[model samples]
Target: MTFLLGAASALQLPAYQALVPEIVPRKSITDAAALSSVGVNLARAVGPALAGLVIARLGVPFVFAANALSFALFLIVLLAWRGYQRPDTRVEPFIDATRAGIRYILHAGVVRRVLVQLACVMVPANALWALLPLIAAGPLRLSSSGYGLLLAAVGLGSVGGAFLMPAIRTRLGIGGTVAVASVIFGATSIALVLVPSLPVALAVLIVGGVAWIGVVTTLNGTVQSFLPAWVRSRGLAVYQLVLFGSTAVGSALAGAASSLFGVLPVMVAAGALTAVSAVLLAARPFPSLTGRDRAPMPSTDVPPVTEHDPALQGDVLVLVRWQVAAGHVRAFLTSMDALGHSRRRTGAREWTLHRDRDHPDTWAEVFRVGSWQEHIDQQTVRRTGDDAGIFSAVREHASDDPDIEYLITPDRTETPHV
Candidate 1:
């Protein structure tokens, strides 16, 4: 049942998060995300108390029935709303779409950076969740209701933090906010081990909640802001994957370490590492919102295709020949490195830059796509303002227009010898 519930949640989270952009203005995306989080934390705060009351009065079965009824009510609300109309576009096969999403994450530096930062913080931060009950029962000597109160404190803090988010983000920016939040949460974790007083612990958790909501909302908002529309749902799906996957792995590790050395030692060590990670990760700060442009770039023309056209069916190899200006070879190479990532992120299966063996001034930039249709998608819907900027940078280093060629395999059965 738990696994089934997790699978359902995994499916729902991406769709839910992606809808925020459609419903809210781009400038207000972060604020909207914070408000959405306010609702979630509110539930986290109130749901337990309500459930406990129901369980006492009507039994556990009634709690489950109420949960089911709430879902039914949510579905009814969803059904009543008119949905957004999206532009009509050709849909790729499911397998191909999955491949594209994976490629994007592997090659897009911005997305990769966000995911790395999330994992770094979440792996250590998960220690709090994994061992909090143990801390309450052992050192703090708290009853079950007392433990619930501690959780309620965190939830209350999250609700309060959402109200303060706008001012906090304006003052701190994403990177500074993340760093400060990490330090605060880390300090709270360490306090858990050192202080052990119920009142002090509740206060610490409330403060920690403020920090938690800030980091989560900031990183999540960054993902939403940076990803282009075509890949937004996929990007959010990957974000959800990293967030939950990190927690699962971290929780397992924390539990094992606690068993070996005890919860207090693990808590202290997790806290220290969380604080240290903030320092290391701060070196590569997230790019500001002003810099990211997710608007679609003007589409390049693709060769016309018919139902029987072989051009539409085959793997594609794109080769671009460039002659670098004498002293600009180094600069050209650097620009190509950035462009290579853009190519792979969009659709390229493999990308490489090769200089002519005898003439170092001549360079060949080559990339392969799984199919012609996929390559066309890259030229059209997949290209974004970020890609346009990278292309412009590369063009600045070139002496003249690049020589381009598109080669497709005529037959699938024939294998080429290298």
Candidate 2:
């Protein structure tokens, strides 16, 4: 199953990238977002029918085999594509780095809120995905063609929702937006089960799809926006783990309920759980929230984000995908401070400032410039003069992220990182 997803990623990302020239997104990131949205839309449209056909005609083992073959093909295609690198020139203290990530998630109110919002809808969502086809084929008594049409309707609705997410998020804030989306999801889930006919059920499912994609996209943006640069990858990994981990549990429960009661019962359970999750999340706000509901605190176990040493030099490399700080304490701080000051001074592009909630002193500024070298070249830094004398004062902190390397984007799938 995992291999098939990997294979899809290899073939699909590039194939979609080819469509970039046509979409002409408002921003580069938005283009990436659009392609991702559309690509998922395409696959979601096909996945149900494909699964139904394989299970109905070919059998479950064949479905599994097909998935494996897809993964193998994706692996071959990905290997054929160039410029994927994971080797590092040096290594550093990783355990402390892992601790730093955990501490921030535990402490950062904003990150917690985002994670909570995702969880609220996601837990019940797994049930919806699991039971949708079963209900369509069972009492719904829809033929294979009808099921395929229903899947297409859901896919179309999701794509529409993705297009609307940015604007809706802008208006509601992540907190309010997610809260509202959760309501829509729960209500739609119930509606899908209650509908008297296939067409009506199809419409409700489409609405559910819209709610699902919009809430998810908005939540993802919220998570990324709130995370500190030093722990962005790790923070995201944690989010994925929780969301997907709950999904697995949801799917399993859906299967059990379907066997014991019926598909409608499983679908109803999803809706009820979704409603409950919304209420719980609104009250508790896991993963935490920022702004008025957020705070910055001091923790003693890790160094603060603002630390600096006089001896650091050019070896200070910004970590890449899953790449963590293996460098010195003082050096990392100095580099981070320099990056923050540089970004603030230039006013050339948008950059976020995040100090660790626990280690307020160990500063780690977060920003995504045009390229990785944007930090080293400090293009805007040359304009600020802050980058000028800082190195001389802080060479003692200099060290490299041995994990630094260029990477190509891949398909979205379960990334199993503990």
Most lDDT-accurate candidate? 1
Candidate 2: where is the Cα deviation over 4 Å?
A: 1-35, 46-96, 281-418
> Model 2 Cα displacement at 119 (Å)?
2.3
Q: Write the per-residue lDDT of candidate 2 for residues 1-418, one digit (tens) a residue.
A: 6798767555454333333323332233332453477677888787866798779998999998887798789679768756544322112246634554565566455666677667656877788778877877776888877877877877888888777776776687556666777788888877877774887877877787778777676666555544433345557767776777778888888889789987776777788878666676567654433332111122221222233232232123232211223455556655656545444332213345444556444334444433323232233212222233443334344332222332322324648578
In model 1, the runs with Cα more than 4 Å from the true position are 56-62, 87-89, 300-311, 358-360, 412-418
Checking candidate 1 for backbone clashes, the offending pairs are: none
Cα RMSD of predicted structure 2: 14.0
Q: Each candidate: how many clashes?
A: 0, 35
lDDT by residue for model 1 (1-418), tens: 9999989998889978987888888888888999999999988888887888899999999999989999999899878778876633468789988888999999887789889989998999999999999999999999998898899989988988888888999998888888888899889899988998999999999999999998899889888877777788889999999999999988999999999999988999999877777885668877556867787775442233323355357888999888887899888888899999999989999999998989878899999998887776787778888887888888888887788888886876667678
On TM-score, the candidate that comes out on top is 1
